[model samples]
Target: MTQDRPIVIGAGLAGLMTALHLAPMPVLVLARAPLGEAAASAWAQGGVAAAVGPDDDPARHLQDTLAAGDGLCDAAIAARILGAAPDTIAALLRRGVAFDRAGDGRFALGLEAAHSRHRILHAAGDGTGAEIMRALIAAVRRTPSITVLEHTEARRLLVEDGRIRGVLVAGPHGAMTLPAGRVVLASGGIGGLFAHTTNPPQAWGQGLLLAARAGAALADLEFVQFHPTALATGTDPLPLISEAVRGEGALLIDETGSRFLADSPGAELGPRDVVARGIFRHLAAGHQVFLDARQALGDRFAKRFPAIAAACRDAGLDPATQPIPVTPAAHFHMGGVAVDAVGRSSVAGLWACGETASTGLHGANRLASNSLLEAATCACWVAGDVAATPAVRLRPLAEGRLPPLPDPAVVRPILWRHVGLLRDAEGLRAALRALLPLAAGGGPASDPATLGLMLAVAALRREESRGAHARSDFPTHGAGRARRLTLNLAEAMQAAAGLADPVVLRA
Candidate 1:
């Protein structure tokens, strides 16, 4: 209710860090569920990436990140964020977040796919996100300047003359236009829009649509990375078998207990997109896919990967006894509301961070463990930006009503089939045709369908197999200048509406 304090939507790591970094200046964090429970940050298991290991440096980290991006990464952004990796780790440590340490009293780093060194800092073993979030939530509880309101959703961003004035929030009491001096959308990713994602059902890219409607440009909407090792138990959001298991020497095996990824360059430690495709293709060829950790981890698997061990146990298997059943499932979203280095959205008085903002850091694909690092660093950047902004009057926007929503049962499969892991010209167009109407009428299905529409349009335009956006039809990358796509709701929809058939990006 305070006018000067900034209003932040989503209480994930980024949102919480934003509020924490802006101490003395109060912040209100809105959440769809209690802090930590519903956040993707809480589900993260790979830990935060940093260049603090003796064998690694920030420049090497930057190089690995650029390689995983599949020719679309912004080198400057990668250099800056990777350069600050150790600082980010120190900042988290200062907040009393304990990371595992070697016997020498130095931080213990773990290895992951596509990285040159063991640079990932984990907590409580495989429960890195849970540990970090637990620490942050506790820190937030002790801070008088930060206030968290759970079970409230931001339905819309209040914009006037290209500036975000506030947001329309919906809760048990009912809808209200909340006035504020600044607004930051820390909302999570678009995985909820897919049928077989590892994300919570509520992370359906609402922030992207809210910002786009408020006139913020969206970037890289086509690049959705799929995790290669989700427990395929037919769960709504399939339980993830974290990539760290592979980094720990787990092998990808097909039927007959033979190695599947043996021919690939990186093998089991390849980029997520490559690993996912390997599993997808293995399944397509009438073979069962599995993660063989029995030999590598042996009995130590239970202690080293407690979370994943429990997940396997719940699925009627044990990593100690046999290979875990696995399949590629939709996971992190690498694109979102485009922002600058300071987390400023194109609209004034607005900022975005975490999975919701595409600040050219991830580019075409995210390197392992970089998500949490980016979330933390970007939150700090946003805090400094907010501290410099001039105060303004917090006038309430007009009364608003959220649109009726669609059941995940109806839209999830359609998204997973067309826009999920592998996309093609024909499938992408059909997806656009079906989603355009649902996207047209503003409401609950509106945001989900809009993201799907944008993804389809972007996939159809790229006409190349790169990173997470694999086009089976296009099969190969085109020879041209590599540039990121930026479009608002109007521009994206206009391009989709004009699509009578499959088309490539106009020369």
Candidate 2:
């Protein structure tokens, strides 16, 4: 409502936190849905990864993160973010987030995949994200300078002379343009592009599309982490069985009760990609895989994981009694619009944080519980950079018709069939062919198709299996030290043009 006020898009953890950090500076937050819904953050069950345990330190936390990233993580960036973990946790506490505590008055720490330390701080058992969001939403509401516009979605970023000028948004009444020099994109990830995912179905990389279309550079588009234990109850957007469940000694067993991952290091607690591939192969072999917590947690399952227990009850099953059926589902994207340490994008006056910005922290694979940490820590820095950057003069904007609302329905099956979990040259090529036309078309599917096209092109060019971007034809890591991949819409479209020729689809 005020002129030159910085605008933050999306009302998720990152966006809300950034606005809160901005303080009395006055900022506007736009939410597509109500404050509590349509955000993957609220559905997050694992908790924040921090070096709060007596046995852990930032150095150990950084080591675990790099190990999980599988050698692609930027050590300096990862170290800086991990170093802020303690302060970030304290910041959350000051905002009224009540983390679960041990009987002795210390923080209740849990373990997750890939981390050697029990450094995860959860609240309300498994409802860590919900609890954090509850605190943040209340904080944002109480802040007098922060204005929240609910039920409004950003349709496009208006960049003039290679700088952000304004945003074209669709609100409850109609479409309108909000002129502002500063815009922060916290619009989340691209999970909904796949047929099955643990993310909110609407979390389909809208931020990426906004950044990509505005010529911001994107990095590591091919690395998508698949959580290995989504509840296999035929839900469109699958409910996640937190890695903390496995951390609590659950075993991955088939219908025959064989521990298929017993021979694998870390077994049920292995890094997500490895565990996901194991389950995927087992499922491909016509075996049903389940998370058997009956022995480890039993009746205690209800107490340790109340939220997950309720989900199990809703599905007509009890985690304490029966082995919960599980399958791999798209969970997180390790890549996004490439940003510097301060979250500034390639385009000036435009910044990105949270799931939308690839700050070289997650790299090829994200360590479990690191996502919430990243969002919480980076949000403060993003707000600082935004506040420090000088405001630019505003120009009058012209009215234009809003683009059709995007639909990922058609893009989901194509990505799942050709680009899901396992990929090869033929499938990648076929995907490019099918997606190129849709991306170039003026239709509701174009935004999703464009993002999918970029991913296909990146996957096709990577040439080897590393982290979550596995290639069946090239099953091993490449010969040299891995480098992060970067691309823009033009580069992606150009690559697609060369590869979109008629190709045989895999049967």
Count the clashes in each prediction.
Answer: 1, 0
Per-prediction TM-score:
0.97, 0.98
Global local distance difference test of model 2? 0.93
What local lDDT does model 1 show for residue 249?
94
Q: What is the lDDT of residue 281 in candidate 2?
A: 96
Per-model CA lDDT versus the true structure: 0.86, 0.93
Instruction: Write model 1 residue lDDT over 127-203, tens digit each, in one string.
Output: 99998898899999999998888988888888777787778888778887788768889989988888889998888
Candidate of highest TM-score = 2
Model 1 TM-score (2 dp): 0.97
Q: Summarize candidate 2's per-residue lDDT along 1-507 as a digit string, tens digits.
A: 337789999888999999999999989999999998899999999999999898999999999999988889999999999999999999999999999999999999999988988999999999999999999999998999999999999999998999999999999889899999999999899999999999999999999999999999999999999999999999989999999999999999999999999999888998899999999999999999999999999999999999899989999999999999999999999999999999999999999999999999998999999999999899999999999998877877886479999998999999998999999989988898899889889799999999999999888878889999899998999877398989899988887888844231211
RMSD list, candidates in order = 1.6, 2.3
